[model samples]
Target: MTSPHDDPPRRPPVISSPRRAAVSAAAVTAVLVLACAALASAGGPADRRDPTADPAPEAVATSAPLDVAADRLTDQTGLAVTIDALSPAALEPGNRLRLSGQVTNVGRGSWRDAQVYLDIAYDPVTTKGALDDANSSDEPFGTRIVEFGLFDRIGAVPPGTTTSYRLDVPYAELPLSGAAGVHRVGVTVLVTNRDGERVEAARADTVMPLVAASDPTPPPAEVVIVVPVTAPIARHQSGNFLDERIAGAISAGGRLRNLVDLIEAVPPDTLEIVVDPALLDAVQDMSDGYAVTTRQEEADQGSGRNGTGQVEAEEWLADFQTVTARQNLLLMAWGSPDASALASQRMPGVVAAAVRASDEFAVDSGLITPTVSWQKNGASTRRGLVVSRIAGAVIQFVAADNLVNLRAQGESAYLPSLVTVPTEEGELTGVVTARELAGQRLTMSTSVLDFRQNLMAEATIRSLEAASAPSPMVVALPFGWNPGDAAEVDVATAFDLATVEPVDLKAVTQSTPAAYPGPIRLTPAQSPLSDELTDAIVRLRTNGNTFTSLLTDNADAAAFDRRLAVSATSLWLGQPQERLALIRMESRAAAEQLRKVTVTGPTFVALSSRSGRFPLTITNGLQESVTLRVDVRAQNPALRIDPIAELVLEPGQSRDIEVTTRSDSSGLTPVRVRLSTVDGKVFGAPWEFDVRATQIGVAIWVVMGAGSVILVGTVAFRLVRRIRTEGLHPREEPNP
Candidate 1:
């Protein structure tokens, strides 16, 4: 008898007859086989086995089936995994996919016996819609690669603690085959939950694009990448910077600086940069010496601090000029105005003026001629198209969603990137930006490898849709896009793919336009400039014209046009307060400049006689010499005044002019004086005064003359009498 916890004793084997002996031997052999199987399944002698090495295939086959709920396999878990890097960005033959990142336990419970495995979907995403779904899907689908010891075994992760993980698996070992397009790849963590079951706890998914060497290279697709180099509106109407933010933007690590760096990194002709000439002009001023206002009111008051980026501005400008010298430069309107907004407001003159300023800047800066026009957000209306055409734009870049009757054959089919739009002026070649790609806003959060893979996937799918036929595509980078230090390489690598053929904007314009199913349809402007802002811009333009008319040189007026355009930039679309403030500032500056050249004189002038001369002073407070015409008028018809045909005054010079006046009657007469341009356009406000002429009448002069003659005759008669009567007075003369 044995106790409940005690082990029972075993009897010794005994052989009886020949048949009994055979049966006993069979039982013994069976027992020996069972013991051997148990040891092998347990990975016999753990000290003799390599923990890091993969176990025999038989070991995995003998293990219990993975017990996990299919619905809960991708459920959120305690661990949060983030992939910091992916080696060999694109999938290539004979290369291994290496991923390194951090795993943090964010839940209240700890994760024990944690393991990170590579998960991949073997099937390639062949359509744009499917690719979009994969990129955006929260519960992405993938099968874990649990063979060949390809996962990292991170022991345990306590609550609110993080641990690093690295997984390297050969490409051939990956569970993908058959297709060479974009495939879904991800990392999943298998941890022992509190229930003591090994299950997927957390996962992160990304794209992996593969371009095999053996695949036949089709006609390369024409790709036009339009990159916008712009900054916020920071310039005042007086050619001074309103703030110093622009200086930082063009510095070493600034947004504008990164743009220049990206341009320099890529092939010179690969990218078409839409540059705001106003930005360049502002930078040029900053390089020479600039004033930054502490307040908006100070901009016109000429009370501001000097900028501190003269050196940086000079270096940046020099580098920009050098880098852009060989690149394709598409000049934006002088201030990068909102063309669609201006068009919607029916202010075509402002748009035309902006375009003219851009053209002039292109010529003056020695940059390439601008043939293509791009509106903010790639949105435009029918009127905008016509206005752009009239403003010398042969081609216009528009958002794909803004056009109708432009659908593709299927979800996987390539959308036409070029079309022809009819306008009043002529036909415009419309370059449609790929809506899918542009929607994926590139930012610091997106890894370089991920972005490159996404781009490659798009290119591959589009090429496949067209049966490898040459397809023209255009991708417009978002305005003010800042590819951080990590993403700079991605931007350059995206275009370096073998399937991508970089082409100039001219090339895209020359390509055949895709046929639409019916008449082309254009959407209305999404968000245009408000009526108040547009009206303000109109007033600014009018005032600016008047102010510039005072300049002796017509060329000087170009600066004002550029400044007015700056007030209507797309940067002000959502900034109503700032836009209004800027417009007011510009208007005030213009008014102040116009007031500089004025006429001044005493409020009252007295003329003692007819044809008397009075003095009036004219002052030129402008920095440059001016040629002005002075016109004088008297309110009373009895008074007459002469006009000064033309007068030249040096800068900051004031001189008094003599006015000849004649009065038919003597009384107080109101007089007005004004300054005008040589072309007879009124320059500034009129100066008014009163002239009191005390002139002597003609009758009085005649009476006085007659009296004087009579008196003289009488005197002569008296003198003769005296001479006869006082003949003896001669002796008195001798005494005198």
Candidate 2:
């Protein structure tokens, strides 16, 4: 939340444009005429000037140089002044405007009476460019404009002390052009001596549009307001929540709180609130103190640094649940990831995991909404919006929130007023915060001014409707990376003119012919996942192969994979570099944890006998015990191993098991085996061992002797009888 007061008084352009130059030249001529008249008047700012050249009365009385009496008069005269805040976001024509600021006397050199006054002048909005551009200039378009003192109070100040003052001036009294567009106003403090000369001290400028007087009966407006409830893409590092931005948002006076206040001000169905599932997961993790990623350079940072920056959740979840239940909730994909940013290879696994996260959240919160449309940075605008693969699938992902933060996306330059985006799904309405007001830090005056502008937009809508043309105004609340408590009241007042509930996006797309009219399309940059992360995700899926219907039975493995998918969420689209690095770190951690259930046994075993059994070890590194089996296969035909049945390994415990094997030939044989789930799929890495069969077994020798004797007897019997000749004739080919 940035306050407009925080911005220093903007300096006017050194070189005026051609138009301004002409206006300035004319202003010069006008000022000369006005000064001549004022001088002749009985009383004015320069009334009854002392003509004496010695110790000029105006300059000497203020104890400052004569040259600075007009432009910026610094407080070499021992007083410092500042504007703290201004009030009433409902600033309309014929209203009172409050300006709050401070004045301090530092040099204490003055012994007589001292007074503080305010100079406020209006400047009109020149352009629509957001911050960083030369869109705005402080030059007064109307040189006929004059700086007037507002609620100037005469007083005295002690040396080395500060005093606060609030100036309430009637809006109609100010020199206003009264046009409907954006206008800039500047305010500064000055200290005047008894000699009638005033010296400038502190200054600030407020840029906002003034609202025209409201019509007696404004036509009804069809509005849909969508508020973004998002946090930075985050992954729990070492079982701890690390994204501090999320923590701050849910804290008091944070983004979440500000948003909640705005939503609560509206009716339950007034606005649809969209939520990011990844945020919910992290907030839940924060219920207890959790560690976050600190230093990448630290070899084993492990997400915890002795409670250095750990944010244990206090009342965030409680507050969230209470506020969200008050309005409609939409489920954003896990991590609020961008569909376009998904890696081509990880899409299937990633979508499945994201869906699961949403389903699980629904189970926890007892709330769910269809994800018909989503907000993508740089894609969500008044004209062009980003869409993905098939529009139908996207219509299914996020469908549902309340505090409208006036922060803009990607760049701070977008129209802050409500805009209606026509889609095949229907009219998708949202606010593209004005470039000048996007992520604004507003106090009182600017808040009212900004609100009045929004309210004034209703007049524009009404005029079009009166012309027999109806167009709904969809508004989006401004968003900020970090919005402080600057424009706290304006957000709630955004709906003051007439309270109209915004239509739900899901219903709009379903009912309206407004399909996703993607006049423009954008594909995300190719996403990258390190080999280690890929391997870990593969293993996570592979590990579940040992279980039937892994989704229902393998809770632990499923949970771990869910975390990986959330970490890989497209929410990091705005932060590509950071996303890649975090994926690598989380995937590496997953691999380490998956390495727990390992196979341990001898690499070589000698077998002198025909049949023998050898023992092996299966160590469980996980916290929970597992029931599994060993899969064995002999690489050499000379050796055979019996099938293994299901077995169990205790947590942090080792189990020794034996396998039966037999060899008939005298040779060396290689055998391989791996841990397998009950469903019979390999688990950890495979283990192999060599078996040396030194001799032929007695069982083979006995079978060979019997076979030889039987063959010899058969030959003798054939020779004994001619009848045996039939048997020999049988060897001949039969008649066709």
Candidate 3:
């Protein structure tokens, strides 16, 4: 038997010679003859058997007992071990590695005399691929450190109970005598089974990157850490917050607060923060004492309770401004909308509007205008790139894995940070972020130490793999990323390692872009916005434009556009129903505003002559001045009405419009009156009234009188003629 400290066995050497080849042939021939003789003695009807027949039952049963026994041994214990804390994340010569965590009896059975030991793989992981596999793998690596007084022992662990454990072992006791690099470190629990066999009950593994003093250190690699300072969308279109979550988020020990604290801890030039203008705008409003509508009904009714985050908002904003003043900042489009979904749905107008609004906000608030566009959730498409180009973005940030061509090149260990993406509008610089490192920032299952060590290991491996000439790499945090308070320090430490040199994002973008393969490849969006939601957004924007035309002031129109942009944010992706509901709410609010300007008139009117004038009341109920035109028409052909000219109304002002009407005949005629904006969009429902012409015209009277006079004269003439011809009485007596 070999000792665990000994190196793994090596393969034997092969010999190639004519004499050995002849001896091997003779041995093979003799073995074949012996096998044929043995088979003939034990077989029955071998010629009739099919070549594809299954093995015999006895042959299959040979391994079944071993599998059953192994399974039975595994089910004997119910222990679960976890590593909560590790001291000295990096191991050095003569230094001790200490770890502490809890072990719980999750299974039904209890474990007696359970012992916890540290398992270290003496063989260091040399390649980046092997390191990644070790980080994600579950199987234990290396031999257990079974030395006395180097492990923790628990007498008994009953069901549904938990126990604490701590293991401390000196570096010398560990069988680690190889090149310094990342190694697989794990904790295993050994329990006795019913068969008196000590089997592994449970195990937990993590990465341990060893940096010894004797090992040669390489030059640091350039890395760009892009941190996102954003929040989920929660504001209503009417400038009221939908909830008070932002208050907690910016308060002490909150997620946003932790980010600010983290930035303060690190060097100002080492980090790049991507800020969402909408988030800052909301916080500014909160600092000014805003209102929050807790329920949808309350929002629809225009009622809300006063928020209580003025102090927190003020503090956070002040700190944010102070830190960002000395640091590099990149502004995202307003609300950080889902540009990919918009492009896929064929809505570039929304993207353009969002970009414009973000620029305006940045200028007004004394912040940097955004020149780079980032895809939400690190997803991108060809059309998405075009939209970004049209939105005035010079650079586009996308996940590395999304580029199929780059992945197919099989150079993931060290890919250039920048690539040129061709679009219809123009070419854009595409910034590729490390997919694995970016994803690791969002994992919460591992301990902070594990997370920090894994990050260091990944960076170290990259540096080692590209030792010849290391290219710049970008590690962009996921959208809405919130690293907890405890992990903030750990994350900072990970970047401060000797193997990594944090650089500003601008440095990476300024470098020459690598040439990408032809025929760009992009992965389909996993959670794209539905077609119905995008169509509704388009309709909502169209209606918003029409509604804004009623206002004479351009500022109010711009404010409404910002609200529309907020509603189309990426926060709504994969949430079609919720987004549709928000669109409906916004539509109703706009309709309510349009209803403020209306036309009211009398239902019935009397006209003393063929031509007359009546009063139609026009009111502007909005808080701002409006310029509109009044249109009136007669429903009957016998009636004619003159059009009213454009008029301006002040806030809460009412005016009576005099409408002129004329009729050819003396009768009642129906007239309809409507109000429209200067842009020719109808404001509200039409008002109808009946106009009765009471008096006839002088021409009609003259014609009637002349006709009567002629009739009388004719009658008189007829009577005189009848008398001359014969007596009128005689002619009447002959009628039968």
Candidate 4:
């Protein structure tokens, strides 16, 4: 979290139109007038002239000239400053002097009014001779100084306006008696703005030609200058674009009822979220460390370093955007920003976006916010104007997370691996061939044995070339290629390729809406029944959630999605038995048999089983004659259930059904299998299953045998002892 103190004072983006520019210019003019008025009344920083104490004052000869007019003053800001203008000056050996100038605003906004200070220095002629393009100017000798400031108010003057100020220094204040062999004199100004932004401006004069006396009192050559960077004041009226957009949202419908409600209420918008650099840095420091892509390695690969730089940039930007968007929704949901600020109204939107972005971006590559800082380099009125641009933005994409990472990984080596595949004779052509052999047989696989093993005995065998041979066909093998191996020839199919095209570098579009991570089926307006169901959808969206979490212990997730289909099952459903929720869920279900789905990850679906039994409970509540028919379907072809058929039950009849499932060779994981119902809701009991090996009656048998052997052995032993020793067990022997 960024502290209020950490915020970089910001100037809103330049929304300069002809009219606006004129308005801004007029505003600047007004600011200058105000600055002059403030200066006259304030007496220019009382702190600079604390007369009464400090050891005492020294008297000097009237013949001596004053070295400087003003001594010390301070202004802080971030804008970079250059000398724009200066006042004329004359200097005599022992005379005092004054200097004045203006600092212009160069950054985005105005700095709240602040004072500017001067640094006076003296350098010997020899020292000046040593100065070069790279060297800093040195202080000259015998300079007296005083301090003064202008434009000290709550806000900065608008950019393009010049705020002028002056300072007076008397020569007697100088420590030097007057060493003179022609020393160079220089003055530099430092201004600090309200936001702690700093700007440095300087001017030097090395042409002061003077001759020193044989008995000379040497001047002090050291000068110290400290500039403060102040934060810029944030200013706005109620009619900004942001205000209008938010107002529109409020007019449509104030606060969103929930996450789904919010989505339904608004279309997607391009958002830029700004975060405190300091807070972000702290978060990054505490976060799980990022993957490091070395500079040397990237260079070797002919690519940019910081493999996740762009990824992190995008994610941080996106998360910020999402959070802000939710904030807007909260404002709408609660009817006003003030209302949304209340915990009750804020929580739902905050939590929802957190949960959504967290779950969505978890598996994402380089999804982290990084810290940044701003340097004040220019001036706005007396304030420092500072700004930095976002690194850059990628074209908006539906699967942006995946698409971005993939792009970063470089063009898919697997792309060319698709389309035309080399075969024994030639290449397989067209989508028909591609689809037929999609997962049927590895088109790139050269191993005849494995190919024949998985294929049906009567399966069609089409060689790349026409063949008249009886059993097998042969052709020239490409040199340097392994003869019989299934290689991933192409990762993309023609259908997949059709979805994307190359984008020009300079032509990249901004804010292209990315399909909000599987928005087609699991939309913002919809919610899953179970946390498990939610996990399943998230897994579908991000490929991050585990399938194990989605399944009912021993059952398949797809099977659960099917058998457990009802209003009570969706995670989005309100508290169990909520009247409004129940009705809404039922209506949604009735409107759609199976939601349309388009998966963008791996195309195959698969399933696995552990051990647990889902207790199935059938309750017959209605008094009228009724019948129920349940049909199950798995989304993935590889998923299957035993006895895949309709389950029928007559009125007043109830039965428990245990359906088992496993994945076939296709490896297509079942996202969900739907169980259609004809009448009455099916309430599924929690499934349970023994995970270890099934023992059956073995434990009972083992115990019974052990008991019988112990009894028989004890009796026999007692009888033998009784027989051996006449004193024993006539009872025991007789019983035996």
Candidate 5:
């Protein structure tokens, strides 16, 4: 019946009111949550739990000894004594040992001016071999050994003082071959209080094993262990005060001095002297046959005053010399080789050849006082080891140059307060820093006092040498001066002359020249400013125009230099049209090229071209506010030029300037504006701008518009539907 054209006007589709719509949404949401919960329940716990990786392995532990101590000691005289046990002992090859035993003078009367002698032995064998061809039989084992002798004179021990002596002995001297499997090694302690006197009661013993090796490898290298000639931190101090002073004077600041100072500076418990790799090599070479290849001596011949001048001296000389010693011999053989066979055949032949070479070099070099000794303290379980140790006497060479001007000599009253010496810069006085010393050539730098006194000694000396027969050059005393201070001197002129002529004093009356005051001891503050000084100074004002310019150029440098620069130019056009135009044109031209300028205080940089940078520096000269116009124009592409950013700076304030560029044609434009403090000396730091692409903002706007449209449409549709539903349901339905 409804299929007919219009069967009982169909009732309008039922539309829900606001409350009904909300109820329907809640019902749908509840159903979806329940479905999700049912699905989650189906999964297993393992699937929901977090995943974990594998575990790591554990660590293992090992043990090692902590300390090695010398536990025991023994005294043996005459007979070769052996120490069987040393307390807390750990003795191994390559590890050195320090031993101390007291020697008392039991005699009633003090041993006046007596001396004690002790010999340090290494290995078991004593007399090894002969290093000299002239001497067939060498000194016996104990005789050839190194001896440390102690002198007892001043502050002699009273009858009951019982002077106790301690000596340091190395482990290398102990017999080691028999103790290879065992941990202990036998030691012999010998003492002779009075040289050649009756030997003390002998004690021979062995020490407990202190060290053991896990591996059989030999030590990497042989070491030369040096014990302080005295107690720890106290080098040579154990001796008399006078002796200590003498040692300090002779060795101050030298290698020996530095080594002693370093040891004293370190903790006392540390006994070994650990040398750096490079220094170790030098020590080893010296311990071996590398004798001190160079030698010289200072001899003071004579001195006298030259008239009114300071004390003058005569010529000095240095003689060339060398000491003859046995050449270092190296013996090598397989570890498995038969000792007797090798010693008889190869060793003898090798020894003969070495002796021949040693004698030849000695005679050829004119080493008149040649003496020789042989040493063999090392062996190898490896294929073999080479024997290398010095076997020669130290030759004394004569050094007689510059004796009159020596620093030590100057310390005495025999020298005058003001001494004249030829220097590279001329005749100067005072102390000097030694730069080079060889033969007749010696170079030195001026000291604090000497620099002021003879600053131009070098040039003055050269000029005087060029003048006919060195004349009495006038020396000007500068602000500060001191005797023994040194200035560089050029002696090339005297090099050609075999000997220097002694100065002849001109006779003068007592009143002719003022009585010469003796040498003045300078205080910490006041310097003598001796008249014998030669001031070295190049007056820039007096130099040639070209030379002056070259020497004084901002970039040109010598030993020292200082500079100050001030520049001002206007790149921005204003009132001074002509001047402004000129500067602008120049700046524009410079802008075309890559321009980089660093400035202090306010600065400005501008550019309007591609492939170019323009650095601008503007100097302010006006007393009040100053303003200038900066023109920016579009050059290539869709160009963009920024406005002139101002820096509000106090008159004295300085800051860096920045400039940036951009093109709106297509794609993203990246431009940088850099602002930084000059060398970070002032306040502010350098920074750059991070600009985002223009398209990103457009995307945000599109998203906001879509969201607004959807919100309005939803509200309108809901309202219209609610109205229709309300119209249909005149009365409210019963609450469910």
Candidate 6:
């Protein structure tokens, strides 16, 4: 057991490095992608960026028709038209829109002759809801912005090949004259020779800025950057990773590197890191000069002999340890517990597990896991749950305000920053994880792009409103972000323009609370798979005591945790059915391990003498020792058996226990012997046996003799009385 007063962090023992296996190509690619993302996330000189390198415009906000395939048309030879990206999504009035994209001939045959045309159109609708209708409508809007004859030229696009084209149109060349709200940019690909052109092969439209009648909208004043530092690791309830996949992937180059880069890039003072200790804990588990394999067959063999696999761990812990030195919070991430689900179901061990994980990681690392720092996903859980006494103090980060009254329900009043409410479990801290529009893929090619852009621009604009404005606007980076798709430089550019600075989430949440008497508004939580997780956790209760006992041992505890890691919310987010199957499997495994503590003694006890002792044997099949007592139950009082002495069995060991029984009178009695912890929790199943008692004790004989003498004396006295009085009456009756 780790001492609470152990202030200094302990370094795991060192082991020799193992043989270097061949790094797979997939592993290499994963590394490169993470590296590129990291470099891009960190800001560089303006000249360093290539305008044409990743020219895809930030996402556009418009819904597409249900049948997106309708956007493309092909003749005998199939051809496809698409806009890979558009730059400068937000543009000033009269700016020349330089749109570039590609046209592909997807048919088996090549196109000897082809022509491309540029079409520009405008839509009056600007709001996302209205745009969605327009985007999804089968009928196109009649408004035409431009029909240009400038860039229509001959081209030969081969089958399985693409033709790239650029259209540079000045604002004066518009057919719309002076109308503007939002413009639709699209490309029309033509298949024809010099003879003529009529058939259009592909037509794809993307939204872009075309504010002709108005001035350009400036970028936001304050842009908050939230980044997630997380990883995918399946766990064993035994406190271990299902395998070495995490270590192997990370040790080489995997998405995890991007997280390391994110931590490194976050500005120190205001760095808000959401750390799920499950990942860290796995690293810790593997670093013990040992680790389990991800392969089912390998793990089936159980963990290796103590000195095995010592070379496999990544030592990623050192980097994480350094990063955690900055301000951060535990994101209820111990095992990525389904907070909303667990809280709703009122599961006993979930809260306890979270608290235990927090204490283990936080206290040992000298880091903070404030009750207020939990990033619950939705608004449904307005109040705290009444969990068992594990979370000494739990703090929540309500999405809307810095400090909620924790008791009020009126309209909320936003304060300067940080609302920390002290509570029994910890602090009910209120800080928002980034809202949808504020923290997500900055350049996703989807309908929500415009809304996201607006939020980005607004934040930047707000910050520039005043020098002392809420400069460090806080935002939590979305979890499960695809590192390969992140537009780090673009986001950084937006932040730089808005004078936005990276601030640690902890510093923001740790700030002094303002007096906001109003109610705190929170985002509604949407846990579609909550029920499944709740069900899984409920089943885990049956295995709790056994699991707890395992936790008390060194090896068993490690094994248990490795299996439990799979429950981490991030890892199971989109895979509820799979998670359910996993939980069931884990529960079954736990039950199986616990059932190994069985009794191996004789099934029957024959007693010739009234008083005697019987020896019973118990076998422990687990890798951990157990301190337990033998409980004896019998049906007959004649079979008196004392509770056997407490026995402690080492892993995979057995012991014999002797119990004494005394009987005054007995024939056959059913008896049961069961094992329990010293505190009286039944283990496995009880052993039922029959006890046969033959001869009585000497005391029984003595008592019987005394009774016989007393009976004789009473009879003699009665007879005398009868003869003298009553007896004489019987003789007279006879004579009459």
Best by TM-score: 3
Q: For residues 1-736, could you state the per-residue lDDT of candidate 2 as single tens digits?
A: 1123322223333222111000011122223334444445745344454666333211001101122213232234544443334454434776777766555544434423333333333433323332112113323222211223443443556554556666666776655556433444334454446675654544334433444543343344455555667766455445554446655556555656555555665556667677776677666766656666653632365535432223434566666677778766777656544343333344455545565666676677666565433433322322222232122224432211111233222332222233334655455543222212222322211232333333333333333233332333344443332223434334444455442325555444432232222233332332334454455445544443333221223565546545655655544445655655665565555456557778877889998888888988888787766777787788887688888777776678888888898887778787887876666555568899889888865787999999999999999887878665555454568799
In candidate 5, stretches whose alpha carbon ends up further than 4 angstroms from where it belongs are 1-69, 74-687, 690-736
Residue-by-residue lDDT tens digits, candidate 1, 1-736? 1124322122112211100000011122223344344455677532255777643221110000111111133225645565656767667778998887767654446678887777677677666666766665436365566654577778788754668888888888876665767777777777887787777776665676666642775445567777788877666655667666788778766778766777777766887778888788888888998888744457437667788889889999998888887678778766767777777777777777778888887787676677456666576666776777788765677777677667653342566777776666656667877645512444223333445556666676665555633457777766665554434244566666666677887777676686532343345545667788788888788777776777776676887777777788876565687768778777877778888999988788898877788788999999988888899989997898866668888889999988888887889998988888777777677889898988787899999999999999999999999889987455544555
Candidate numbers, best lDDT first, in rank order: 3, 1, 6, 2, 4, 5
The TM-score values for the models, in the order shown, are: 0.71, 0.57, 0.72, 0.18, 0.18, 0.59
Q: Per-residue alpha-carbon lDDT of model 3 for 606-685, expressed as tens digits?
A: 88877888889999999999888888887777887877889999999999878888777767778888877788877688
Model 3 lDDT, residue 554, Cα: 53
Q: Write the per-residue lDDT of candidate 5 for residues 1-736, one digit (tens) a residue.
A: 0112211212122221110000011122223333334446766222243346322111110000000001112112111121211222334456554323223322233433322222222222111011111011111122111233221112233232333333333555443443212121212223335563422232222212211332342121111111111110111101111112212211333223323333333222222221111111222222232211101100121121111101110000000000001111111110111111112222322222233334443355354423221111111110011111111211101011212223323122111112333323343222111111110111111112112111122222222222221221111111111112011112122211111121111110111221221221212321211111101001111121112122113122110110000001001112233322322332332232111212222133332223223333433322222222222334333546565554333333334344344544333333333322112111112222223223235576789999999999999999899888786556778799
Q: Which stretches of candidate 2 lie over 4 Å from their true place?
A: 1-94, 99-139, 142-167, 171-221, 232-238, 241-269, 281-314, 370-480, 486-490, 498-553, 569-593, 599-623, 627-671, 676-683, 689-736
lDDT, each prediction = 0.67, 0.47, 0.67, 0.25, 0.23, 0.49
lDDT per residue (tens digit) for residues 1-736 in model 6 = 1123322212122221111111111222223333344445666222345766733221222222222223325433455554433445544456675655556554545565455555555333343333333333222233332243434444677654666666666656644434434444455555664455444555555444333354454333333345445556665444445544465444424345545644554445434556566666666667775544343533475663342323434446666667656645444536555444455566545556555655666667666555322433323233332242245535444444222343222232122444444444654444544343322222212222233333433343333233333324555444544332223322222323322344455456555554433343333333434665667766665575455564335444433433443353534565566567667777777678778888866688888886888888888888878777788888886678875777778988887777798876759899888777666667688888888988866788999999999999999999998898865654545565
**Which candidate would rank higher by TM-score, 2 or 6?**
6
Q: In candidate 3, which residue pairs clash?
A: none
lDDT of 4: 0.25
Worst 10 residues of 5 by lDDT: 315-324
Clashing pairs in 1: none
State the lDDT at 591 in candidate 5.
Answer: 30
